[model samples]
Target: MDFRFQSASPASWADVAADALVVVVTSQTQRKLEGALATLLKEAVAQGDFEFKAGRTLYMHRAAGVKAVRLVWVAAADESPKAARAAFAAAFGALKQGGTRHVAVAAAWEAGWQPAQAEALAAAAAEAAYVYRHTKPSAPKPAAWTKITVLGEKAEAKGVQEGLTRGAAISAGVTFARELANRPGNHCTPTVLAEEARALAEEYGLKVEVLDRKAVEKLGMGAFLAVARGSEEPLRFIVLRYDGAPRSKAPIVLVGKGITFDTGGISIKPAAEMDEMKFDMGGAASVLGTFRAIAELKPKLNLVGLIPACENMPDGKAVKPGDVVTSLSGQTIEILNTDAEGRLILCDALTYAERFKPAAVIDIATLTGACVIALGHHRSGLFSPDDELAAALQASGDKALDPCWRMPLDEEYDEALKSNFADVANVGGRAAGSVTAAMFLRKFTGKYRWAHLDIAGSAWKGGPAKGATGRPVPLLTHYLLDTAAAPSRA
Candidate 1:
C-alpha cells in the first residue's frame, strides 16, 4: 500500500472516513488526542464508549472537529517513545517498525494498495502480535492502547482492511509452519504431507507440483530417493511457486526437507524419542507457510519453494550405511549414517536449486541434534556464507521476534566430512556434528550466497518426549519482505 500524508481541512478529511480519532488536551494533562477531538494539544479524560483503561483498547467513531485519526497513548503523564509504541502496537496489532504508524494511517484505506505493500503491513503487524505474546517481565505501570484514526474517504476503508487482512494471512502461515514442525512423525507421513500441501494450494491461489517416486527418479534426485526407499510410502517432491514479483527478477528459492518420518534408514536412529522425527520436515512446512503468505499478500517478489519430501525408514529397500548415492549435481555422497538423511535430501534440493538460479537460496532442516545442544530451544542456528544476506535475515528476525544465532561454517570442519568412497560423507562424526552437517551441504551450494538454518532445537522442544515446536516461519517471511523491498544489487 502506498502511504503518504496529506494536509486537508477537517471537513474534507471527515468526508473521507466515517470514524476518526480527534486529539484534545484538557485540564492539567499534557497534549493528548481524544475521540474526534476539538483541540490538537488538549488533554481530556477518555469518555464515551471508547474508554481508555490501562492495558486495554476502545474505538471511536468520527465526530466534529476531528481531522485525522489520532491514537491516544495513555501513559503516566510521562512515557517514552518505546513505551508509547508498545502500547500503540498492542492496541492495533502492529509491528513496531519505522514508518509503520505513518504508513498504516494511509494503508487503512479500503482500496488502492498493491498486494506487496498490503502484505507487508499485515506481516509487520502479525510479527508485532507474535512478539507481544512472547515478551515477559511486565512493569508495574498502567498500560494503554494506541489509537489510529482513518482520515480518508470510504474508498480508503478497503485499503485499511486490506492491511489488517494481510496481517491475519501472515499469522495463518506462521501458525501452519509451527503446526508442521510440532507434529510427530507417525502422524505426518509422505501421503499426509502431500494431502496438506494440495489442500493449501487448492484453498489458496498458489500453484503446487508434487513429484512422485518416478518423477523424483527422473530428476536424478537419487540422494533424496535413497532416503525414502526404506519407507513403505513412496517419496514426494513438492514444488510451490508464487509469482507476484516481476518475471525478469530471479525468484527467491526456499528449499525444505520433508522427511515425513525418519527412522535413520538402515543405519537406524536411536530408539529413544524417535517420535520427534515427525518434525523432520519442519523446513518444508516453513517454506510452504511462507509461500502461503506470499500468495495472500501477493508481494511483487517471485517466490519458488521446493520440498524434497520423503521418509527415512529402516526397511528392506532403505539405503544403508556405506551406501553411495549421486546427487543431482553429480557429486557422490558416501552414506556414513542413515540418521544423517537431512543432508542427503538437502544436497539434491540444492542441486535442484540450480534450475531456478535464484538470487539467493535458503534451506531449513532439523538436521542435527548438536544444534539443539548448542543453541537450546531459544534460537535456531543460522549459517550463511554471504554477510549481506545474513545481516538482512538477522534484522528481519529481530523485527519479527524470531531470533537466530549465527553458527560458524569453519573450514576446519570440512575435513571431518571427507569421504574416500565418494566426494563427501553424510556424517561428520560426533564433534561439531551441526557444523559438519552444514559443511556437507555447503559443498553443493557452489557460488550461490546460501543460508542453512538448523531448526532442530527450535522445531521441537519438550523433554525427551517433547512435541514439535513449529519455529522460524515469521522470521523467514520477514526476511523475504526485507529482501523484496531492498534495492536491487549487482
Candidate 2:
C-alpha cells in the first residue's frame, strides 16, 4: 500500500478528495464541541445512531459538504500507546470493510502522537490490511484501498515522514515473515527458505552464503545433521551478513531454528493439528524478516543472521530416542527424544556463531510446546543468562508492543538435563520444560553474550485466526535500531 503524508486539519476535509476520510474522537461528548468537521460529525453521530467509544468506529456515506465518499470517526480511549495503536487499527479496519479505495487519516495528532507513535500507527494499519492467499488456486480479491494519506500539522511533517518510512519497513518485514511462515511445508522447505534468503540478499545488496549438506558435514555439525538425516530434502545452513559498520566491529549474531516441517521424528506428536508444525520454522522466518527491515533502514551496525534450516521427519535413519550425538562444539548430547530437535540444530549454530566473536548473540526458536503452556499465546518466553541483555530485550519488546516475559534460566534447571552418557541430555523431563530447553542451549553459548527467545507460544495462532503472527520481529528490530543509535563500542 502507498502511504502519503499531508499537512491538513480535520476542517480541511472539504478540500480532501478521497474514498474515505478518517477522524479521531476522544469521547462521545467531544464531537459536540467546536470545529467545522466536529459539528458535522456530531450531527452524524446523533442521526446515524452511533456511539463514540474507544476503538469504536462510525461511518457516514457522502456526508453533506464532505468531498470524500465516506467519513469515518474513530474513538480514542486516551493518548496512551496501546489505545492509539488500537484506534489506528480500528480505523484502518473500518476503511477496509467499507470498501474505500483511498483513505486520508486526520487523527494521528489527536493523542499528541509523536514519531514513534506515528510509526506504530502505520505499522498497525499495514498489519490489519494484510491477507495471505498464497495457497489459494487463484489470487484473492484485490484490496479496496491502495493508498493512505496521514494528515498532520506542518511542524510534524519531518517526524511524520520518518515515522512513515520506519513503519513501512517494519510492516513489510512483518508481512514477509508471515508469508514465509504461512506457506505449506511442501512449498516452504529448507531449500526454499534458503533461496528466499538469497533473493532477499540480492535485492538488498547484503552478503549471502548457503552451506549445503556437504559443507555442513565437513564442519562436523553432527547435532544438526542428526535432525537433517531424517528428511529427503537437503539441509541448508543459511548465513546473511549486513555490514553497515566497519569490518573490525563485532557484529550482533542472530541464530534461528529452521525446522521447515517438524513431524516430531521418531518421538512423534499427535496427529491432531500436526499440520501446523509447518510453522516450526517461524524463528528462521523472523530472522529473514528482520534482515529485510535492516537492509531497508540500513542501521549503522553490522549484523549476522544464521539459520540452521532442515526438516525433522520420521525415518529409519532418523536419530532415535536415546541416541547420543557430538556437536560442532565437541559437546555431546544424549537425545532422549527426537521431537526435541530444534535445540539440537540450534546448539551447533550457536557454536558456529563463536567464529564471528560477536558482541552478542540471540537465538529465536519454536523450541518447546511447554513454553506455550507456560506463557500461552499472549507473549514469547525470553531466557538470558545476562541481566543486561535481558533488560535491553524487555525494554525493546515493551516499546514495540511485542511483549516477552522473562523466564528463569537458573543453574538449578540444568540438573534435569544431566546425562551419564553425554555432556547433556536433550530433554529434561516434563518439569520446567521450557527453562530446561534454554539451559540446554546455554551450554553452547558460553563464548558470547546470548539470549534465547522461546517463540513457541507467539509464533502462530490456532483455530479461526490460524496463521503466523510474525511476532518478536518488532522486538528484534527495535533492539537493533536502538543498538545502532547508541555510541559505537570500542
The model with the greatest TM-score is 2
Q: What is every candidate's alpha-carbon RMSD to the true fold?
A: 8.9, 1.8
Candidate 1 residue 77 Cα shift, in angstroms, is: 17
lDDT per residue as tens, model 1, 366-424: 88999988998888899987888888877777656567888898788999988899988
Per-candidate TM equals: 0.70, 0.96
The candidate that achieves the highest lDDT relative to the unseen native structure: 2
Note the Cα lDDT for every prediction shown.
0.67, 0.87
> How does candidate 2 fare on TM-score?
0.96
